[model samples]
Target: MKELYFRAMDAIHNACLFVAGAFLVIIVLIIPYGVFTRYVLNSAASWPEPLAILLMIVISFLSAVVCYREYLHIGVGVLPAFLHKPAKSFLGWILEMLMVATNLFMFIWGIKLCQTTWHQAIPEFPIITVGLAYLPIPIGGGLTVLFVIERFLTQKFFSEPEPETISQLTTE
Candidate 1:
Protein backbone atom coordinates (compact mmCIF):
# COMPACT_ATOMS: atom_id res chain seq x y z
CA MET A 1 0.00 0.00 0.00
CA LYS A 2 2.71 2.42 1.05
CA GLU A 3 4.79 1.55 -2.00
CA LEU A 4 1.90 2.26 -4.30
CA TYR A 5 1.24 5.56 -2.60
CA PHE A 6 4.87 6.57 -2.84
CA ARG A 7 5.01 5.67 -6.50
CA ALA A 8 1.95 7.79 -7.21
CA MET A 9 3.52 10.67 -5.35
CA ASP A 10 6.73 10.30 -7.32
CA ALA A 11 4.75 10.59 -10.53
CA ILE A 12 2.93 13.66 -9.28
CA HIS A 13 6.20 15.26 -8.20
CA ASN A 14 7.78 14.67 -11.58
CA ALA A 15 4.78 16.07 -13.40
CA CYS A 16 4.83 19.21 -11.30
CA LEU A 17 8.56 19.64 -11.85
CA PHE A 18 8.18 19.22 -15.61
CA VAL A 19 5.34 21.74 -15.80
CA ALA A 20 7.25 24.27 -13.76
CA GLY A 21 10.38 23.83 -15.82
CA ALA A 22 8.49 24.20 -19.07
CA PHE A 23 6.82 27.38 -17.90
CA LEU A 24 10.16 28.78 -16.80
CA VAL A 25 11.52 28.16 -20.26
CA ILE A 26 8.47 29.77 -21.81
CA ILE A 27 8.80 32.80 -19.57
CA VAL A 28 12.46 33.11 -20.50
CA LEU A 29 11.60 33.04 -24.18
CA ILE A 30 8.58 35.30 -23.77
CA ILE A 31 10.17 38.24 -21.95
CA PRO A 32 12.90 38.51 -24.54
CA TYR A 33 10.37 38.46 -27.34
CA GLY A 34 8.27 41.07 -25.59
CA VAL A 35 11.33 43.28 -25.20
CA PHE A 36 12.42 42.76 -28.79
CA THR A 37 8.99 43.51 -30.17
CA ARG A 38 8.68 46.72 -28.20
CA TYR A 39 12.20 48.03 -28.60
CA VAL A 40 13.27 46.87 -32.05
CA LEU A 41 9.93 46.75 -33.83
CA ASN A 42 8.44 49.79 -32.05
CA SER A 43 5.34 47.73 -31.29
CA ALA A 44 4.45 46.21 -27.96
CA ALA A 45 2.55 42.95 -28.11
CA SER A 46 -0.36 42.92 -25.65
CA TRP A 47 -0.67 39.18 -25.24
CA PRO A 48 2.91 38.51 -24.14
CA GLU A 49 2.76 40.41 -20.85
CA PRO A 50 -0.56 38.96 -19.75
CA LEU A 51 0.42 35.51 -20.93
CA ALA A 52 3.68 35.69 -18.99
CA ILE A 53 1.85 36.73 -15.83
CA LEU A 54 -0.56 33.81 -16.09
CA LEU A 55 2.25 31.37 -16.76
CA MET A 56 4.17 32.77 -13.77
CA ILE A 57 1.25 32.10 -11.44
CA VAL A 58 1.04 28.52 -12.60
CA ILE A 59 4.80 28.10 -12.32
CA SER A 60 4.88 29.54 -8.81
CA PHE A 61 2.14 27.29 -7.44
CA LEU A 62 3.36 24.12 -9.14
CA SER A 63 6.95 24.83 -8.10
CA ALA A 64 5.79 25.35 -4.55
CA VAL A 65 4.16 21.91 -4.50
CA VAL A 66 7.36 20.36 -5.86
CA CYS A 67 9.44 22.19 -3.26
CA TYR A 68 7.22 21.02 -0.40
CA ARG A 69 7.39 17.43 -1.58
CA GLU A 70 11.17 17.55 -1.82
CA TYR A 71 11.54 19.41 1.52
CA LEU A 72 13.18 22.28 -0.40
CA HIS A 73 10.97 25.07 0.90
CA ILE A 74 12.53 27.56 3.26
CA GLY A 75 12.26 26.60 6.96
CA VAL A 76 13.58 27.93 10.23
CA GLY A 77 15.65 25.18 11.80
CA VAL A 78 17.54 26.93 14.59
CA LEU A 79 14.79 26.37 17.16
CA PRO A 80 14.43 22.73 16.19
CA ALA A 81 18.17 22.25 16.40
CA PHE A 82 18.23 23.32 20.07
CA LEU A 83 15.43 21.02 21.18
CA HIS A 84 15.97 17.57 22.69
CA LYS A 85 14.92 14.46 20.79
CA PRO A 86 11.42 14.14 22.30
CA ALA A 87 10.76 17.87 22.08
CA LYS A 88 12.02 17.97 18.51
CA SER A 89 9.69 15.14 17.63
CA PHE A 90 6.73 16.96 19.16
CA LEU A 91 7.63 20.17 17.39
CA GLY A 92 7.85 18.34 14.09
CA TRP A 93 4.34 16.95 14.61
CA ILE A 94 3.00 20.38 15.45
CA LEU A 95 4.61 21.91 12.36
CA GLU A 96 3.29 19.19 10.05
CA MET A 97 -0.24 19.62 11.38
CA LEU A 98 0.04 23.37 10.90
CA MET A 99 1.17 22.84 7.30
CA VAL A 100 -1.81 20.55 6.71
CA ALA A 101 -4.18 23.17 8.06
CA THR A 102 -2.65 25.90 5.91
CA ASN A 103 -2.86 23.80 2.75
CA LEU A 104 -6.52 22.98 3.50
CA PHE A 105 -7.33 26.66 3.80
CA MET A 106 -5.57 27.40 0.51
CA PHE A 107 -7.44 24.60 -1.28
CA ILE A 108 -10.87 25.60 0.03
CA TRP A 109 -10.50 29.31 -0.52
CA GLY A 110 -8.84 28.89 -3.91
CA ILE A 111 -11.81 26.89 -5.19
CA LYS A 112 -14.16 29.59 -4.01
CA LEU A 113 -12.08 32.24 -5.71
CA CYS A 114 -12.06 30.28 -8.94
CA GLN A 115 -15.83 29.76 -8.89
CA THR A 116 -16.47 33.42 -8.16
CA THR A 117 -14.37 34.45 -11.13
CA TRP A 118 -15.58 31.71 -13.44
CA HIS A 119 -17.71 34.01 -15.59
CA GLN A 120 -15.11 36.72 -15.94
CA ALA A 121 -12.89 36.77 -19.01
CA ILE A 122 -9.33 37.94 -19.14
CA PRO A 123 -9.00 41.34 -20.79
CA GLU A 124 -6.00 40.47 -22.93
CA PHE A 125 -6.96 36.88 -23.66
CA PRO A 126 -10.70 36.81 -24.23
CA ILE A 127 -10.74 33.06 -24.79
CA ILE A 128 -9.43 32.22 -21.34
CA THR A 129 -11.54 32.68 -18.22
CA VAL A 130 -10.19 34.21 -15.03
CA GLY A 131 -11.09 31.01 -13.25
CA LEU A 132 -8.69 29.08 -15.44
CA ALA A 133 -5.89 31.44 -14.52
CA TYR A 134 -6.51 30.86 -10.83
CA LEU A 135 -6.85 27.08 -11.11
CA PRO A 136 -3.22 26.39 -10.08
CA ILE A 137 -3.82 27.56 -6.51
CA PRO A 138 -6.30 24.85 -5.61
CA ILE A 139 -4.44 22.29 -7.67
CA GLY A 140 -1.18 22.98 -5.87
CA GLY A 141 -2.86 23.03 -2.46
CA GLY A 142 -4.53 19.68 -3.12
CA LEU A 143 -1.25 18.14 -4.27
CA THR A 144 0.54 19.47 -1.19
CA VAL A 145 -2.13 17.92 1.03
CA LEU A 146 -1.54 14.53 -0.59
CA PHE A 147 2.22 14.90 -0.21
CA VAL A 148 1.86 15.78 3.45
CA ILE A 149 -0.26 12.68 4.04
CA GLU A 150 2.43 10.63 2.31
CA ARG A 151 5.04 12.13 4.61
CA PHE A 152 2.99 11.24 7.68
CA LEU A 153 2.35 7.70 6.56
CA THR A 154 5.93 6.98 5.50
CA GLN A 155 7.34 8.32 8.77
CA LYS A 156 4.98 6.18 10.80
CA PHE A 157 5.37 2.91 8.89
CA PHE A 158 8.76 2.98 7.22
CA SER A 159 12.32 2.99 8.40
CA GLU A 160 14.11 5.91 6.74
CA PRO A 161 17.38 5.25 4.94
CA GLU A 162 20.56 6.61 6.47
CA PRO A 163 22.17 9.67 4.94
CA GLU A 164 25.43 9.02 3.18
CA THR A 165 28.53 10.67 4.64
CA ILE A 166 31.18 12.50 2.58
CA SER A 167 33.52 9.53 2.81
CA GLN A 168 30.85 7.14 1.52
CA LEU A 169 30.11 9.42 -1.43
CA THR A 170 33.81 9.77 -2.21
CA THR A 171 34.20 5.99 -2.36
CA GLU A 172 31.29 5.64 -4.76
Candidate 2:
Protein backbone atom coordinates (compact mmCIF):
# COMPACT_ATOMS: atom_id res chain seq x y z
CA MET A 1 0.00 0.00 0.00
CA LYS A 2 2.76 2.45 0.90
CA GLU A 3 4.64 1.58 -2.27
CA LEU A 4 1.55 2.25 -4.31
CA TYR A 5 1.03 5.59 -2.64
CA PHE A 6 4.64 6.54 -3.21
CA ARG A 7 4.41 5.74 -6.88
CA ALA A 8 1.21 7.72 -7.23
CA MET A 9 2.61 10.80 -5.54
CA ASP A 10 5.87 10.51 -7.44
CA ALA A 11 3.95 10.46 -10.69
CA ILE A 12 1.99 13.56 -9.77
CA HIS A 13 5.10 15.37 -8.58
CA ASN A 14 6.91 14.55 -11.85
CA ALA A 15 3.98 15.76 -13.90
CA CYS A 16 3.93 19.09 -12.07
CA LEU A 17 7.66 19.44 -12.51
CA PHE A 18 7.35 18.81 -16.23
CA VAL A 19 4.49 21.28 -16.54
CA ALA A 20 6.45 23.92 -14.69
CA GLY A 21 9.49 23.34 -16.90
CA ALA A 22 7.31 23.66 -19.99
CA PHE A 23 5.90 26.92 -18.64
CA LEU A 24 9.43 28.26 -18.18
CA VAL A 25 10.36 27.41 -21.77
CA ILE A 26 7.15 28.89 -23.10
CA ILE A 27 7.75 32.13 -21.24
CA VAL A 28 11.32 32.33 -22.48
CA LEU A 29 10.36 32.00 -26.13
CA ILE A 30 7.04 33.83 -26.03
CA ILE A 31 8.27 36.89 -24.14
CA PRO A 32 11.00 37.53 -26.66
CA TYR A 33 8.58 37.00 -29.47
CA GLY A 34 6.19 39.46 -27.92
CA VAL A 35 8.92 42.07 -27.58
CA PHE A 36 10.06 41.60 -31.18
CA THR A 37 6.56 41.82 -32.53
CA ARG A 38 5.70 44.93 -30.50
CA TYR A 39 8.92 46.84 -31.09
CA VAL A 40 10.09 45.72 -34.51
CA LEU A 41 6.82 44.98 -36.25
CA ASN A 42 5.02 47.78 -34.39
CA SER A 43 2.27 45.33 -33.54
CA ALA A 44 0.08 45.55 -30.47
CA ALA A 45 0.49 42.14 -28.82
CA SER A 46 -2.05 41.54 -26.07
CA TRP A 47 -1.23 38.07 -24.80
CA PRO A 48 2.48 37.72 -24.06
CA GLU A 49 2.86 39.88 -20.98
CA PRO A 50 -0.09 38.35 -19.19
CA LEU A 51 0.84 34.86 -20.32
CA ALA A 52 4.37 35.24 -18.98
CA ILE A 53 3.10 36.40 -15.63
CA LEU A 54 0.73 33.44 -15.43
CA LEU A 55 3.48 30.98 -16.27
CA MET A 56 5.69 32.56 -13.66
CA ILE A 57 3.11 31.88 -10.99
CA VAL A 58 2.94 28.23 -12.00
CA ILE A 59 6.72 27.91 -12.04
CA SER A 60 7.18 29.58 -8.68
CA PHE A 61 4.80 27.34 -6.76
CA LEU A 62 5.49 24.10 -8.58
CA SER A 63 9.26 24.45 -8.32
CA ALA A 64 8.93 24.98 -4.60
CA VAL A 65 7.16 21.65 -4.21
CA VAL A 66 9.86 19.90 -6.22
CA CYS A 67 12.64 21.60 -4.31
CA TYR A 68 11.23 20.54 -0.96
CA ARG A 69 10.77 16.96 -2.14
CA GLU A 70 14.34 16.64 -3.38
CA TYR A 71 15.89 18.09 -0.16
CA LEU A 72 17.01 21.06 -2.17
CA HIS A 73 14.97 23.73 -0.42
CA ILE A 74 17.04 26.36 1.36
CA GLY A 75 17.86 25.79 5.04
CA VAL A 76 20.56 26.38 7.59
CA GLY A 77 22.40 23.12 7.10
CA VAL A 78 25.32 24.15 9.30
CA LEU A 79 23.51 23.58 12.58
CA PRO A 80 21.93 20.33 11.51
CA ALA A 81 25.25 19.00 10.30
CA PHE A 82 26.74 19.05 13.79
CA LEU A 83 23.85 17.30 15.47
CA HIS A 84 23.49 13.58 16.15
CA LYS A 85 21.31 11.61 13.80
CA PRO A 86 18.30 11.56 16.12
CA ALA A 87 18.52 15.28 16.79
CA LYS A 88 18.93 16.03 13.11
CA SER A 89 15.97 13.89 12.24
CA PHE A 90 13.92 15.57 14.96
CA LEU A 91 14.72 19.00 13.60
CA GLY A 92 13.84 17.89 10.12
CA TRP A 93 10.48 16.70 11.35
CA ILE A 94 9.81 20.02 13.03
CA LEU A 95 10.67 21.98 9.93
CA GLU A 96 8.62 19.72 7.71
CA MET A 97 5.65 19.99 10.06
CA LEU A 98 5.91 23.76 9.85
CA MET A 99 5.93 23.50 6.08
CA VAL A 100 2.84 21.33 6.26
CA ALA A 101 1.15 24.01 8.33
CA THR A 102 2.04 26.67 5.82
CA ASN A 103 0.75 24.51 3.03
CA LEU A 104 -2.52 24.09 4.87
CA PHE A 105 -2.87 27.85 5.16
CA MET A 106 -2.20 28.23 1.48
CA PHE A 107 -4.70 25.53 0.60
CA ILE A 108 -7.46 27.19 2.62
CA TRP A 109 -6.87 30.83 1.76
CA GLY A 110 -5.94 30.18 -1.85
CA ILE A 111 -9.34 28.68 -2.53
CA LYS A 112 -10.98 31.74 -1.05
CA LEU A 113 -8.77 33.96 -3.15
CA CYS A 114 -9.75 32.03 -6.23
CA GLN A 115 -13.43 32.27 -5.43
CA THR A 116 -13.20 36.01 -4.86
CA THR A 117 -11.77 36.57 -8.32
CA TRP A 118 -13.28 33.66 -10.22
CA HIS A 119 -15.85 35.81 -12.00
CA GLN A 120 -13.46 38.55 -12.95
CA ALA A 121 -11.74 38.41 -16.34
CA ILE A 122 -8.29 39.63 -17.25
CA PRO A 123 -7.94 42.64 -19.55
CA GLU A 124 -5.31 40.90 -21.64
CA PHE A 125 -7.29 37.70 -22.11
CA PRO A 126 -10.99 38.15 -21.68
CA ILE A 127 -11.70 34.43 -21.60
CA ILE A 128 -9.32 33.71 -18.72
CA THR A 129 -10.62 34.31 -15.23
CA VAL A 130 -8.66 35.99 -12.48
CA GLY A 131 -9.26 32.81 -10.50
CA LEU A 132 -7.69 30.77 -13.24
CA ALA A 133 -4.53 32.78 -12.83
CA TYR A 134 -4.66 32.16 -9.09
CA LEU A 135 -5.20 28.44 -9.50
CA PRO A 136 -1.55 27.58 -8.83
CA ILE A 137 -1.65 28.79 -5.24
CA PRO A 138 -4.00 26.13 -3.95
CA ILE A 139 -3.05 23.45 -6.42
CA GLY A 140 0.59 23.81 -5.50
CA GLY A 141 -0.21 23.88 -1.84
CA GLY A 142 -2.40 20.81 -2.06
CA LEU A 143 0.14 18.91 -4.09
CA THR A 144 2.78 19.81 -1.54
CA VAL A 145 0.62 18.31 1.17
CA LEU A 146 0.34 15.15 -0.85
CA PHE A 147 4.11 14.98 -1.14
CA VAL A 148 4.69 15.64 2.55
CA ILE A 149 2.30 12.87 3.37
CA GLU A 150 4.16 10.55 1.07
CA ARG A 151 7.46 11.47 2.66
CA PHE A 152 6.11 10.62 6.09
CA LEU A 153 4.73 7.29 4.93
CA THR A 154 7.99 6.34 3.25
CA GLN A 155 10.18 7.08 6.34
CA LYS A 156 11.86 9.94 4.52
CA PHE A 157 10.59 12.51 6.99
CA PHE A 158 12.65 11.02 9.79
CA SER A 159 15.72 9.93 7.85
CA GLU A 160 17.26 10.44 4.46
CA PRO A 161 16.00 7.85 2.02
CA GLU A 162 18.55 5.81 0.10
CA PRO A 163 20.37 7.53 -2.72
CA GLU A 164 18.80 6.80 -6.05
CA THR A 165 20.39 4.67 -8.75
CA ILE A 166 20.98 6.33 -12.14
CA SER A 167 17.86 4.98 -13.80
CA GLN A 168 15.74 5.89 -10.76
CA LEU A 169 16.95 9.45 -10.97
CA THR A 170 16.24 9.87 -14.68
CA THR A 171 12.96 7.98 -14.95
CA GLU A 172 11.15 10.41 -12.65
- Candidate 2 residue pairs in clash (backbone atoms < 3 Å): none
lDDT of 1 by residue, 9-68 (tens): 988887887888788899999999999999999998888888999999998998788767
Model 2, 89-137: lDDT tens digits are 8887887788799999999999999999999999888999999999999
Write down the TM-score for model 1. Answer: 0.86
In model 1, pairs of residues that clash are none
Error of 2 at 12 (Å): 1.0
RMSD of 1: 5.0
Q: Model 1 segments beyond 4 Å from truth?
A: 156-172
* Model 2 alpha-carbon miss at residue 59, Å: 1.1
What TM-score, computed on C-alpha atoms, does each candidate reach?
A: 0.86, 0.87
Please list the Cα RMSD from the true structure of every candidate, rounded to 1 decimal place: 5.0, 3.2
The whole-model C-alpha lDDT of candidate 1 against the native structure comes to: 0.81
lDDT of 2 at 67: 70
What lDDT would each prediction earn against the true structure? 0.81, 0.82
